[model samples]
Target: MLSHIDPNNQPTMVDISEKSDSQRQAVAQTLIQLPLALKPYLQGEELILKKGPVIQTAIIAGTMAVKKTSDLIPFCHQIPIESCKFVIEIDSTLKVMITCEVKTSYKTGVEMEALCGASVAALTIYDMCKAVSPQITISQTKLLTKTGGKTNFKRVPQPLYGLVLTGGKSKRMQQDKALLKYYDQPHAKHIFDLLSNYCEYVYLSARREQWCNTELASLPTLVDHDDDLGPLGGILTALETHPEACWLIMACDLAYVNAGTIEKLLENYHDEVVATCYQNPEHGFPEPLCALYTPQALKQFQRAKTAKIYCPVKVLQMSNCYFITPGLAQEIANINTPDEYHQVRHEHH
Candidate 1:
């Protein structure tokens, strides 16, 4: 599983040619326990030793180390560091805390650079204060945070869940749309099974009448609220049910949606935006039925509900959203009428 090793078990540099350039950043921390003999050098927040200002010297050394990290580590890419910063402070427990932050816009991340910078800065501090006592100990060095790679490291992580919206009244179809079998099972079950492959959990949002009256009865279901907000009501119910997890909402009537479409949506997800959706080819607006909604997106929908705006697309337009082009013209198509449903069923088969 290691990227640095090749098939032949020889050490190799990871190929970054296929990776896209992004704004990557990493922060690393190093702790140094100062001996009691060096207490007199601490003048206010500044630590000035006989060799010069200790903090300033360590910062300079760390900056150099950040730029020269490729030389120190064999596998590290020579990243063009855009920014290198340091924060040095002494706590009440006489421990000198050194933190190094590195930023770069490149195909590879700068975590190693940040870690190297903090480590060298700790070493420089030890060298400067060694004249006072050889007991200066470099205690810990670790990466605090990193972003803009394949995955982001954070203190708290959110679980991703799937919500199949099956509560809509199919007035045009004149039948329960969720119960129609498109792929050897109910369409609602098809989408639920699709989502189960990628999400932590998958639930069906259905009306009270459909809860146990159809093929989807055996599945996990969330009864829609009686307020009659349609799909928006089901979305709000799921969000409120599990506020800690992000929801990927899929309409049961989407006949053309496949696993690839869902993968593309999740690949483009960004936490800063309220939602990530596809641009509706027909309307030039966000396709809310097949989109990923974050916890913050729930607030937007709640505000819209209070203002009597029940349209999920309108709510998404009023707030910030990231949109990607649908892979195919039918990727966002949902069958509302019996004619369209029959045509799609024939075409899909």
Candidate 2:
């Protein structure tokens, strides 16, 4: 089932007439191995040759190739390229690494353009250095990443950590809300297990005192460092502890947030924005709990916290957040008070 093949097995271009235009980007890399004879020409980081700046010439050729990618590739669409950038470096091992990044705003992706750009840049490098040695070889031309297609893909994804916020004071519930058992286990453990299914690591974001119990002490915990900030404090603690990690933050009292709801949230996630969350169907606000937060979002939260903005919902509202409506609005509801807890507990379980 080739996308560029017709029913009769004839080659054809994909019909993107009905597709909506979006910002698309792709990155590709190519490796070129040079001979030891070229080492004398490699001064510092630049390769100086009578061919007039080998790297610069290759960059120009790569940029041109990126623009004319459609002319070379049979099925590629003629996309108006927004930008093409190249980074070429030569190592002590006489190996040159060329990276090509291509950007466009079009219906189809620019993966082919990026691949062409890198391949052509490697070829140009080989052409310039072949006079020095016939042993120059090009290898490993591949796409590294792509965005704005049906799905975004990355060769090396950032570490995704999960946090179950259980640091709430729970005054309204007349009990520790996280300790309430909606399922067979405690609420916090249920959410922790659910998040564990998807994330690389899962932790219970709890207050230090909450860990006094043997049961709570046994679970992996990230104790709240900031005091009296509710769920915001737990989130900040998790982010501060692992600055490089992206988070899937969930509250303990979100009784209806099952595995399926988390899957939907993850399916809509993209790292370009600060966060990805659900649009609260009742109030038209972004649901901060049960959301995915990246490092970019964490930095903004830190700035907002310094400015005395503690509401997670408000921070999400002001930031660049991708919001999607849940299949069922009730799946995003959290039990904040005794009445709410009792009602949901009786109705659901």
Candidate 3:
């Protein structure tokens, strides 16, 4: 049946009053081909022009478009959007991909809202960058995925990897804690196993000298590219190696961490945040070692590195990070000293 056509052959809005309210979501994407000359101006995640920051302005414009979708599109029902998220990425080819995801609990789907948001965002990018080069082009705009209603659908999940941080000096532990046996296997291996259950690829973050472990030799490893920076260097190395995939980072000393905690982290994951981390019960700050870092977080870390700031926790604290308290406080317990390690080992055994 035609949704916008009445018996009189006039465009009409479909009556959705009889339809039951259900949670609905839609994701739409658009690509903007940026000029090569303008690529260098994109410092970190956004470019600043006379109007303002390019990506940030586009995000605000997209959100406004999502809310005004019905007003712009004839016969489209106005939806009270529960949430709107935008992910903007610029690739090596100077192509910008803008994705807008909209969610609502309404009778009709939000495909129009998502599409409108993406289209407006692309246009805003073009307007902001046009002074630099008019060669910019809005290549494509289409709905990537949607959910709810009778026909629920989804695209494949984004490529997400895992990084197990084992690059620390272990000075407090008085030994290489990563090689310490926790469950008849190396501590690094145990954490690797936990991350492997959720990620398609899992890598051990280690120093060059620590690569001698026979068990870790067979698995993928991201050796630290820089020295003296500790876990911050390892995280930057992982981000440099895999710039596209989000990294789920876990420290080797987290002896009490289990698959449940990892699952909860994934379930509550927020893509828009720089990083999603568990709040340290003792410190009341984000636990950086066991967290999800998106590309934005990586960019922020790189900026911090250039400024001689080497603390990952400080970076998360300063950026747009999401922190949640774990269901079990012990899930974030890190076994730093030999006594603590021994106690945790004995308790588990």
TM-score winner between candidates 1 and 2: 1
Q: Give the 10-residue window scoring lowest on summed lDDT in candidate 1.
A: 149-158
Query: Considering every candidate listed, which one attains the maximal lDDT?
Result: 1
Give the Å error, residue 25, model 2: 18
lDDT of each: 0.87, 0.86, 0.87
Model 1 residue 96 CA deviation in Å: 34
Instruction: Write one digit per residue (lDDT tens) for candidate 2, span 1-349.
Output: 7998989999899999999999999998888889999999998888999987899999999999999999998888999999899999776777788889999898999999999999999999989999999898898787788999799876532698999988888888888888888877888888998988888999998878686754567789998888777778888888899988889999888999998898777766655568889999999999988898988887878887898999999888788777899989989998988888888879866
List candidate 3 stretches off by more than 4 Å. 1-157
Q: Give the lDDT of residue 79 in candidate 3.
A: 88
**Best of the two (1, 2) by lDDT:** 1
Model 2 gets an lDDT of 0.86
Residue 107 error for model 3, in Å? 12
Residues 240-265, candidate 1: write the lDDT tens digits.
89987888899999988899999888
Model 2 — which ten-residue stretch has the worst lDDT? 264-273
Q: How good is model 1 by TM-score?
A: 0.61
